[model samples]
Target: MPPSHTPVQYTTRIHDYPLHYTEAGSGEILLLIHGSLCDYRYWRWQIPALSQHYRVVAPSLRGFWPAALRSADDSFSIAQHIRDMSAFARRLGEGRPVHVLGHSRGAQIALELACGAPQEVRSLILADPGFRIAGEAPGAPLHTTVAKLLERGEVEPALAEFVDAVNGAGTWRQMVSWFKTMVTDNAYTLLSQIREINLDVDLDRARRLQCPVLLVGGAHSPARYGSRLDRLEQAVGQARRITIPAASHGMNLANPKAFNQGVLNFLAGLRADEARPPAGIP
Candidate 1:
């Protein structure tokens, strides 16, 4: 069994919202971000492994499980989450550049923060995140959609459908396994926006990355995904991509060994690259 993860909790205010985060180990800062419907618990594997050589900071994203809800405007917009994360980095990064890892929706948020504050971020690992169209009907708000789903018991099914590759039957079954009851309870309560409330990032702006980057995904991910990471590699100009063969959409949970090793290997190479002297220097 993997050693238990004992995280030290820290509560701080970012803008007007209260931020709840966990910290452990001591070295260069390594920030971890979780996707929608998940709290920091999602990074349990990487947190302990990475912490051995880096200071780990995992925050419960606002509008997600362990964080406070600030707006009825589907509080989990990419912009607000990015802003909040940037604020957290500004306040907690403590003058040292930090490395960041984000999964799913969290990956989108991390991308925005790194773009907006390049100096604060030394490297980034973005896992399996892409665009999502969440709204329909101009006048019908996203929260209204959530309410309708609540009435029709469609929420879990909808969420489960998201991981069809993992769930053999389809959405409802997948949702039951992915969201679970407790996670669903929290998810249904936080109203969402008709569309992503913040930044709109897809393959378009991937070329703008200013730091070392690692694009991560599952080797067995659904074939429908068109290798966005491959596109990112071309655009980023200095980024690398790695897929975990033993994993699926959710690599961290499904194949922790491969995920941890992939991350550690990449981080080690990054540190080595930085430590190496200018090529051609005597």
Candidate 2:
């Protein structure tokens, strides 16, 4: 098994909301953004390995576990998350650009950050980015069904359906107890997520990103994610794609060794490129 270490916890105020996060190791900052039904804990398998080279900071988005919603009026949309994270990055990096790695829904927010606030991001890594691309056919209303189940208080069933919908059939059953607990903790967020509009990304927006991008995918993941990555690769000028074998939606957790190595190699190459002298330099 890969090395695992407990990360130090901290809370910071962003836009008047207290955001909770975990930090480990030290170096260039690497902000981790998790997807649906997840929080900072989702990066448990990542912090230990990646932290050796970079300061890994994983924040639980507002409304997720450990971050209570202030009131029923508190917002929970992608735009709000993007704003929170942009501010969070600025505060954490202290005016320096930080490396960013986001998974699933978090990947969409990371992309938006890279596009909207280019100066704050040095490079971007997206794993199975979960967003509808403009012109793609509408997917089934899985979120709607999950929301209904939550409304009925069938939280487990609702999460199971969603886990299977994205990761593949029987994924929920195979999930470890800890993972299940994490999912259950953030179940209510699905209700708010389903209500959000404009979750789709367009090629023009993807084209606006100015940093290097690494797209990671699970070899066994559903075709939809692969298709989205395809479109993104075509749009982004400096994008690279890789797939982890024997994994699905949760590739990092499923195959951490390969996932970690791939990410580190990408970051290392970026450093090497930076070290190389400009062309025609003596």
Candidate 3:
């Protein structure tokens, strides 16, 4: 049976910052990293099912909801997040490697951690990874308009613009109340996110990853995301790609059953491979 919807919440200091997270179930650690304008609560559909098989820990990144910035001076950057998450995984695993999964911007962080600190990550799962590749033509800035709307205190419009830009037109209006609330809570994070620049992941960095990688994309997602996954699959020797039917960038939430099953199947395959003896020995 799946665990309760409300997981146990906890807080721990990483890099002297209070990192908030939710914990559920037991066994191998599966760290979940949420994307832009989301917090730990973003995994509402994932925790219950995923926790049944493995320990699930989903953290709200600094500057996001439930981990609010202490002051305007508080820093927010992808590098800082990568550093904090690397430490967070180590602390959670206690010298053991843990499986890492991330969505959108968080996926970029997961990829960075797996490449930068391969010893800390047992495996990696990236869902619609949100980042520009080194050679890709620079896309028009989507954040500037949203940030401007936010600065003018047009919160809903800002959220709408950003949400629609990522998922599709009218997504913000169609979103459920809880999802809207979650995004609204961290809306200010976009201001900080826009300030950070030149953090694109390099293809060479993808090639450096030693852990097995699962690249997941939504069947109806933007072509750019699919292109990124394609490049990544070619770069990462052990990478495998999967698509969730009839879903977009928010595939996990849109089709949790398929997403959950696909993730479980990938992890199960890993466990089975690990259980097998060397080809020459057995």
Candidate 4:
């Protein structure tokens, strides 16, 4: 049987956006945010694992399913996403600093939170973030990207491709619903909106981060746009990068073992440091 999952529930409106959240486990807080074309469930693996040592809160971003915001801007712009995510963190974190892990586009959001609220963020883990290429801009609309996602093939094949990646991870059955998200709000429409927008990471702003940051990625992934670990490290003064050789963009599913272990190891270092801070800092 799968391990029992106990979810702590909470709902709060962040700037008129009804933020639907799921809290599980207990201890220091770790906020998990998802990238575009997905919701909070993307971190299903992290919560149960990290929950053993920390309180985990994963929330659906502003316009995702369940608590869809009004027909507001649907483009998954980094700044807008950052704003929404930051508001949710502040309202939920209750003024206490917390660690954060964001995957793909969510990684950019995590960086924005750290950049905007450094003191409120203790540490950050950006996994395969699209930090923009040498000659790219940020904040594109979603419709364009959705178009691209579908243009590659019909929805069925796109989903089949994704399902194929997570086949052995035990979540293949769930892919049916997971795949439905593509057509949500007109899949291509949303993708086109998101793609047209300048959806890139802001490294110039990242230079201000004062906390420990880790950039994780895999050896195999479409891996276009930005999202380079080395660039992430350079952007943030106190940052490092880790690459999972046998993994792909779908690290959580394609390579759960290494993905989980890599995350645990990084968090463990933070745990040790938190336990023993620099002299006179307490």
Task: Please name the candidate that would achieve the greatest lDDT relative to the true structure.
Answer: 2
lDDT by candidate, in order shown? 0.69, 0.89, 0.89, 0.66
Worst 10 residues of 2 by lDDT: 65-74
- Residue pairs in collision within model 2: none
Q: How accurate is candidate 3 locally (lDDT)?
A: 0.89
Candidate no. 2 TM-score: 0.96
Q: For residues 1-282, could you state the per-residue lDDT of candidate 2 as single tens digits?
A: 133445567999999989999988899999999998899889988888899999999999989988643223248988899999999999989999999999999999999999899999999999998988888887898988988888888889999999999999999999998899989888888888876533688789779888999999999999999999988988887899899999999999999999999999999999999999999997
Q: Give the least accurate 10-residue stretch of model 4, judged by summed lDDT.
A: 182-191
Q: Which model is ahead, 3 or 4, in terms of lDDT?
A: 3
RMSD of each: 4.4, 1.9, 1.8, 5.1
Tens-place lDDT per residue, model 1, 11-80, is 8888888788887788888899987667766676777777788888999877765653433455557788
lDDT winner between candidates 1 and 2? 2
In candidate 1, what residue range of length 10 has the lowest lDDT sum? 131-140
lDDT at 33, model 3: 97
Please tell me which model should have the higher TM-score, number 2 or number 4: 2
The alpha-carbon deviation from the true structure for residue 221 of candidate 2, after best TM-score superposition, in angstroms, is: 0.5
Candidate 2: regions farther than 4 A off: 1-6, 68-74
